[model samples]
Target: MVQFLNENGEFAVASKEHEIYAQFIRDLRESDFLKFYRDMARIRRFDNEATALQRQGQMGLWVPAVGQEGAQIGSGHAVGPNDNIFPSYREHGVAITHGVDLMSIIKMFRGVNHGGWNPYEKKFHLYAIVLGAQTLHAAGYAMGVNFEGKVATGNPEIDEAVITYFGDGATAEGDISEALLMAATTNAPLVFFCQNNQWAISSAVETQTKVPLYRRGEGFGVPGIRVDGNDVLACYAVTKKHMDDARNGLGPYLIEALTYRIGAHTTSDDPSKYRDAEQVAYWQARDPIIRFEKFLRSQGIGQDFFDEVQAAGDQLAAEIRETTFALPEPELELIFDHVYSEPHPLIEEQRAWLRGFEESLGGHTPTDDGENKVDYGGSR
Candidate 1:
């Protein structure tokens, strides 16, 4: 495995042979390390709180990103503000790093919004639930950037690159294959970031492919590298190099982050049925937050710093809980509002029919609390 910080939190000595990969971390400032620690810790706290909320029936479903924080936060920090990110549904850590409102994501799981935030404003695309679909979207967006003459502009601020996140399961989808072809043939400035998080809803990585996931990228004519995804330093170094290459008009690159899915696939999943307890314990020993915490302490960071971050995380959780409960459910009629930019006869006819049907069944009435209460039996 490619690792800079070992499991014991000690920095590994780099030989002359691996200097190219090691150089990405050689110039790190003290603040950079602290930021990485802070981001990872905050996301893990959010993940835990969200999972608890789901168990408490506050959310419809929740995807826990506990173990993979190193991969997501490291890669998230590597990209500049101009770069666009396309994320699969479980990229809450990456979203947090990009300054996405945590409540917006909470609202999504609460089933109040289709996507809770504006994508263009954050340079982070909405979460794509359909597997592997975002890869094609990312490729297309990157191609558009190329067509707009954003590449080779000699201006880092204007030269944009696209990064798409997916899991080991998504690699099996035809959309990912198509995306690879599109990116390779067009030479689009894109990066295919695959977090090979051990299990795709109980189907092990062994079942997905015979060879390593990164090797598949090589077959598609894009250079691929596998990194120790549990090590934030290694993930940061590798991703930073590839993202820079893509922005420089070097076409697409692939990174297979070898991490483990420490939690259930989602709140609805039961990993106990398929996976063994031993496997979970092994990965738990390699917890990214714990490892990163050790590294920070070794650098003279004290308990006070950690305590401050923990308190901040606690405040964020409280805010998310408050906002989630306050979010109002959208009315049935509002769904048709954004279906078309201009008036459409078909939409208008459907909306009218639905309204009339509701009226015939004794339309919803306002309750004492100002909520619309629909009576299934009859009109109030």
Candidate 2:
């Protein structure tokens, strides 16, 4: 069923098997393919650097979206400027492509704030860390689009849609089930994109399901399809088509992207405890960034293009390291600022007390030990 992409990283149309992607790819030119290729490269570089920064004691924690770039970039392109995206924490690719400040994402890893930006203001929502909970918000948001007249206005340019991402482990949650039921019944203009990176933390895909996750959506009466989660082109083409479908009021579709999670679930995890060494080595050989770059070069993208993207990626990584390390630690007073938009009298009194306490301590300030410093201004 995953035959759309083979070991050689070549793609083709297999009848009724990846037909949607097969048809979609025929419409894309080499230039379109390069967009996905470039995104995958940049985000993977960012992921690696973030991991390094965390190990070097610069970040609070890091979530490596290393092998999941194809899933992230493919679905991300389906979104328009007016559309909204709800992402899981590992969606660095989606966030970066949507004009999210690179340093803003860095701040989250730097532990300066829960989320670095407002979702509505950015057109991309904050990353959801609650297992599979974003599905419901995505459904409600899609329903809101309908209520707001954002879908099917006889003008595709004005219409909007959503692509919500989760993982294989998230499928078991009631929120995911309820989201599917609501989307199926309401025909919400959303795409439920599952990046089945073959693991839910420590659990493997086989344990997560007896049948494929895409097929599960069929029970809800939505059209579901599987993609080569590593095949960036397939991911991009199928997702763009489905998002266009939602914008056209064709209703929700499910995409179960099949890929391997090459890194531990997060920096806190150790894959060697649960996964076989050979299995990890095999997927590493088939890494999405390397495979996509190979396909892009095969399609006539030059070594210069590769070199240019590589240079840009390296710069972005270094910038992430420097900027994240330099991000201001939240002012001691800011902890009380956003807690309530309208401050309570008691809260204000407590803030006053804390301020007085700081003043009494000689304006107690962190003295940088040359290695650790905190920046208060957001995402510098």
Candidate 3:
């Protein structure tokens, strides 16, 4: 029982968790402890409120990050500004930590666009809905690093690494396997993170594999380690070490975070249909947000601080509400923009035809269901 951070905000890993790690935490400074607590609280607030917006119909659909805030926020803070991040769809916390606009995430859930921010701008890629696709992208990017001669240059400040996050279900995908193989062979500067939220759709972990998912990386010649995902300190410490290792040309590492989803898989999926009520109840007691808050209070933080944190959380929720309602619908012409750098003749021709049809109807095509259908004649 290595108690990394005690109930009171002090830094010390409990001896029960790991003998060596206890000493490691005793060496950690107070500033890092406070940062972990702050990041966890904010990420939790963002997800909790985002879910409410979904139910209120303020957004089309939302994937609640519910229980994994510790895992996300912890690892999110371990990177240098120069490092890159690749995330699967439920990584709103990482986006927030990276300074992505919360309102842009709202617009995505509202079905207004794919993503609101540019990957190049933040060095954080867009969320990949296709399971395990970003892992390959991460591996390829690492390969590019090798080509650029970034590996093992021995300058911790100058060299960089990559991190890709996927779920337990994705560990079973061919893309994940291929990515691991590529990274292992090339010794690419990458980190593979599997959140292991357990259930993949209606199927449970028993249905996926008997042994742990992190072990999958070991067979591929990449070292794998497990962390208590709900423990923000554990997540941060492990990821930070691995990231630093990668920066030092240690190649790749895989981390499997042991945690529960604590909510439905997404807005559209109903966990109640497949999971037992008692199981959900058991995990809810171990909620990451609540657990971390308790840890904070135990560290001598008073109700006043707690009250202030809650107030900040409330303000964040209200601000998102105001922002969501204020977003204007984008023009239809935006669909034709950004497809290509150079205009294609076919695209131009289609745009002209649509413009002519709209002008024929006096610049605005009526979408009234009751009106007779308008058939703009084309070439015979």
Candidate order by TM-score, highest to lowest? 1, 2, 3
Candidate 1 per-residue lDDT, tens place, 82-131, comes to 99999999999899789998888888888877884889999999999999
Candidate 3 per-residue C-alpha lDDT over 319-342 given as tens digits, one digit per residue, 9 for 90 to 100: 888888888886655556677677
Backbone N/Cα/C clashes per model: 0, 6, 13
Q: Tens-digit lDDT track for model 2 on 121-214?
A: 8788888889779999999999998888888897867899988889998888889888888998998999998899888888888776788799
Predictions in order: lDDT: 0.87, 0.81, 0.78
Comparing 2 and 3 on lDDT, the stronger one: 2
Looking at model 3, how many pairs of residues clash?
Answer: 13
Answer with 1 or 3, whichever has the higher TM-score.
1
Model 1, stretches more than 4 Å misplaced? 13-17, 356-380
Better of 1 and 2 by TM-score: 1
Q: What is the Cα-based TM-score of model 2? A: 0.91
TM-score of each: 0.92, 0.91, 0.89
Better of 1 and 3 by lDDT: 1
